[model samples]
Target: MTQHVNEFIQQGLRVLDIERAGIDDITPSINQDFAQACELMLNCRGRVVVTGMGKSGHIGNKIAATLASTGTPAFFMHPGEASHGDLGMITATDVVLAMSNSGETSEVISIVPVIKRLGVTLISMTGNPQSTLARAADVHINVAVQTEACPLGLAPTASTTAALVMGDALAVALLHARGFTADDFALSHPGGSLGRRLLLRVSDIMHEGERLPKVRHDAIIKDALLEISRKGLGMTAVVDDNDVLLGIFTDGDLRRILDQQVDVHTTSIASVMTARCITAKPEMLAAEALKLMEDKKINGLVVVNKQQCPVGAFNMHDLLRAGVI
Candidate 1:
């Protein structure tokens, strides 16, 4: 068992080392051809149609998704399917990105004449720049690797990794060239946690009205404690008769007051509360509010309006529940 475990570890490391070298070898391929491909895709009037076969098809699908999400409209078409009826998906204004490790995949090469006939810009990513597909493309990116990570040299290991890295390079370069912002990324991923953090506002997740935890400035410490417990936010806002916020009292304050032996029944909540504490605006991004809370070392915040009144309140738990933490 010990000998087998050592063999497994050694083989895993060997694979990783070879794959890393393969990626490093392709770094020089991001040259004039890559820049020209990006220029064509950036100025394309229609979507980018990505096509490949077998292992390259899987990588092409991922590349197309990354492009679509990062401001470039793109989709993957199986090269075999393109020779059937899917060739209709390509247009003269669109750009075609084809991938094949050997640069001679019969299925991919079979459709090149039709793609050229449509006058669509053709970009090829292959390990052999001298092969037919690479020679036929308007732009060719060489993703050649020294050797396969597989000990047998039969599996598509290092070559697929090199292609994946090159695809990422293209996607990120186009993303930057298009000036895609975080807001634009959030718009494309509204159902994901990143979108929730970037798009959700304090007002959307905060407890307002009857759910808000607040007490009068003259209210006793016991009254503030009761309000905090009732609202379940671990804190309460202290406000005057005009409904303007004066201060905030939290569970931490209770601990400090307990050490001082203050009378909870008679002591005014305002006397021991944190005055002018950290606050959030209703329109503030939940991500920004989270940063503020983290920077201030606080777990809760009072949401104030333009009139300095506490309109809502929330705690770390609320952010966690809303997937903003």
Candidate 2:
């Protein structure tokens, strides 16, 4: 039993090694048809319809999502469903991207005839160049691998990896050709953390109006401390008579003041507050503010306007709440 387990582990490692090698081998091929694939997808007016069967179907679904999120409009359709009225989803303006390892998946191949009959552009990703799907396609991208990662050469391992990588290559190439920006990506993934970091601004997360931790510059340090305590932001913004920002006093400043035995009751916040404080505009990205805080080794910031007036305040806690951390 011990020897059998050892053999199994060895075979597993061998499979992984072969799969990695197969990925390396396909790099050159990716460069070959990459430009042509991008041109076809970029010029496509309608959605990219991805179809496959079995393990290939799983890879096809992921590829479709990657394409859709990266500026290409795409969706996956199970070829089995195409036989039962899903064929209506395809149109003359749409482009069809079909995936199969052998290039002869009957379920996928069956749809090829109908797709071609409709005069839709057909792009096939397969290992065998002479296979039916490849011959029928308007563009055939070869994603061939040396061998399957399975020990008995039965499982879909390296082949699927190659197909998936090829799909990603196509999507990213199209993304670059289309000049897709981070804002565009955020729009597609608005609910995810990446979207929150990119789309959310300081104004969206900062405490505004009555929630702003602020005090007049003429106010005593003790009064400012009370405002900080009330707002629970560990700091308070010091503003001028016209409500323009002057400086800020934080918990760190309080510690420094206590070290010098400064009188909180008699000392004005303007006297002890740190001027030239780092601040962010309300229109700036919250992610940029988060970086500033991390780089400065601080936990909080005051949001200001073009006139350097305190409009809002935020801290690491706010970033956590807003999902920008």
Q: Which candidate comes out best when scored by lDDT? A: 1
Writing each residue's lDDT as its tens digit, candidate 2 over 1-114 gives: 876998889888998899998898678776646667677889999999999999999999999999999999999999999999999999899999999989999999888888
TM-score of 1: 0.92
Cα deviation in Å at residue 37, candidate 2?
1.7
- lDDT per model vs. reference: 0.95, 0.92
| Counted clashes in each candidate structure | 0, 0
The local distance difference test score of model 1 is: 0.95
Per-model TM values vs. the true structure: 0.92, 0.93
RMSD for each of the candidates: 2.1, 2.1
